[model samples]
Target: MNDSFKKIAKTIKKSNSIALFTHISPDMDALGSSMSLYYAIKSLGKKVSIFVKDNITETQATLVDTNVFEKDCNQSEYDLFISTDTPSQKRLGDYAKIFIAGQRKIVLDHHLNDDLKGDLNFVDTSYSSCSEISYQVIKELKVKITPQIASYVFMGLSSDTNAFTNSNTNASSFKTAYELTLADADITNINELLYKTHTTKEIDLKKFLYNNYHLENGICFCLVTCNDLKKLNATKADCDFFSSELINMQGANFAFSIIESTPSFYEISLRSKHGYNVRDVAEKFGGGGHICAAGAKLKYESIEKLKDTLVDTIKYSGE
Candidate 1:
């Protein structure tokens, strides 16, 4: 409906080949939105490729036809490079070069990060999910969104909003929800795959992570070492559902999950209620996201040191 949306539609219309991508360890929203856009682009009889850091999980493998690449293909052979749901170009993982080195790039995202580098960027943190933005793009393009496309968009929105439970859910989100319903997107099917489909390893890892959570000063924290991941045979995607749940604790104003991806380093995921400023907390540690949810990485002598620093950083007035 706006000038930028119309420009994006025209860009997509003219491009013959487009490659869609997301950050590493693609979450449901990232994967869902990327695949949804892939389908919409491919429907126009253009060549489209969907790239991620790794192969799709059994849960999401069925959501799209990902045969464009065999194994993390790095060749940049597309006319248009489109990235979705990612904050930084570096977050593009193996395909970061394709985004940075490519001539034409379009970034559609919802995360609150200032590192957006692209020829045409549609970055809005106000939207609940990148999928919500994707829906608007397709609508502006007047593209025929198939049932499967709508379903993937629904999954992306539902996952990022925590089933519409997060604070970002707004009137636009609900209006998109209504449009998806009109498009005959199976809400039941989407919910079943999202909520009901979980591996035993993921479930066990979540339980272990929750049990290990340490609550102090209105901040809920947990540390999952690499060994913990090996024990659960879980990948980063497996542990994603842990951070938001910790914030669900009735009394806790904030929650943090520090995952030890390697020795002497940890990836910290932060979440908080409406009043707490999580972006400020994440920025202190050189990470960023939304006010309610954000993340940072810390290199420490030990995990204990990381915990101590984070605990001190979170202990502020009006918390």
Candidate 2:
């Protein structure tokens, strides 16, 4: 609809081979948007490859064709590189090199981080999800939005908006969802897969969260140590939505879930309600995300120290 979108369409039209990428620790939005674009580009007879450096969560994996992603790819092979849902190039992990190697690069994102790294950038923070922007881009390319593509787009929209329950959901998100449905996207299956189904291990993790959690200064928080994960035979994927679950507490203004991925490396997920901006809290620890939902990773020392620091950070930021 604008000059940039037209340029992006032209770029994709001119390219023969395209590589699609999302940030590391791929979520439903990242995977969904990337896969949706992949299908759209492939339909144009362009050689397309999607790369993911990390294992996708089982919940997100169910939404699309996972076989299209190659964990290992030659960075120098692609003609055009497109990054979706990634705020910055550093978040690409090992796949950043592909972006650097490509003859041209484009970025489609919804985060406030506007440090544009792509040759052609489309960063719209007003949109609910990058998938929403991607849907528009795919349409601009004049590619027929197939049922599979619509399903992938719908998964991204649903996941990032928490099935349209989060603060980011708006009129545009609903309109996009309706369009995807008209294209034959399976909204029923997408909702059931993302929200309704949970494995025994996942259920155990939820139980553990309820049994062991702390509430202070309007922050409901929990820590899952590597030992705890091992005892429960659960992976980080099993605790995927724990932070969101924490924010569901009766009086919680915000929530945090800190997971020790290794002996000294910890990953944190934060969610906020009541107009709290968790992004500022996440940025304090070298992480970035949306206003209401964000994440960070830090080195573990002692649980007490980490908890104290985070409590102070969230309290200070929220005020």
Candidate 3:
């Protein structure tokens, strides 16, 4: 990755304009990598356009300026299209055509089973968070890591690792945290926003999870229907932490959250402790991610059918 990093740096240095993208339903790792790279590229006096779909979460607004994401752009205008933290074409939403149309393509991701290829690919599953890779790329680009950049990178690293309590956290993650701290990362604010603060809506969602989750055969799971969201006055953001929390159960080896964003449409967020693998389960549903943490979004005929099938899959296959 060292030589590849330098090569990507050279490519960025030569490009006059660049477009940046991340997966839809962006998480902190996705936003942190894209936003930090956007600023780093802009500081080099290059034109930058970033596109992200479904900016429907409050946490997203708190981390980056969603206003900067371009609604439309002629892909031909950019010399390079760089995708960060996005692993597949469908994950790009409608922007896949734009990336395909770019004069050059670069992929910076840390996910498994990638379907989105690039002229310059740097996909490494060893990374704990895409922000760690972004920090290295920013360093290679010779961009000074200001407090703002440090804070953004820190947010992604901490969030993805669940404040470094997750299985993915490693020496590299801690090293990045140390470096970001030296660069004056605003960890205090990020901690407050990500971990400490929770609205009444989130509290209600948590209570519902406590009352509703099913624990069977060492699998703890919850299914939050669209009607549940309406009754609670909450959104998908409120349920983001449910899967992680479920995995924290002492007796559970596998945990999953099935969220119905719309009727007959479900988003599966899977987590596994004790070395159980869930990435294959996500891939079976046409989704892919890390081993311990993975997700897939698909439509089903009914919530009951989806739950039954997913539970059986985990029982017979995911373990």
In model 2, the runs with Cα more than 4 Å from the true position are 1-3, 114-116
Candidate 1 — what's its lDDT?
Answer: 0.79
lDDT at 262 for candidate 3? Answer: 85
> Model 1 over residues 1-319: C-alpha lDDT tens digits?
1238778878999998887888776777887788888878878888887776564566666565556543454455678888888898657766787577777888899887567577887888889999988888887767787888898899889888888888889998888888898898878977877777777776787779767988776888788888887887776556766778899888889888888877777888899898788888888888888899888776878777888888888886245
Residue 235 accuracy (lDDT) in model 3:
77
- Local error of candidate 1 at residue 148 (angstroms): 0.7
Between prediction 2 and prediction 3, the one with superior lDDT is: 3
After TM-score superposition, the amount by which residue 237's alpha carbon in candidate 3 deviates from its true location, in angstroms, is: 3.5
lDDT of 3 by residue, 1-319 (tens): 4238888888999999999998888899999998889988999999998887675567658867788888787877899999989889989988988887788989998886367888898888888899888888899999889998888899889988889988888999999999999999999988888888886767787899999998988999999999998998877766878999999888998899999988889999999994799888888887878888888999899888988898888888743
Name the lDDT value of residue 72 in candidate 1.
Answer: 51
Q: Candidate 3: worst 10 consecutive residues by lDDT?
A: 52-61
Ranking of all predicted structures according to lDDT, beginning with the best and ending with the worst: 3, 2, 1
- Residues 70-156 of candidate 2: C-alpha lDDT, one tens digit per residue: 877776678889999998667888877667667888988998763447888888889888999899889988999999999999999
**Backbone clash count for every predicted candidate, in the order shown:** 0, 0, 0
lDDT of model 1 at residue 171? 91
Clashing pairs in 3: none
Q: RMSD in angstroms, candidate 1?
A: 2.4
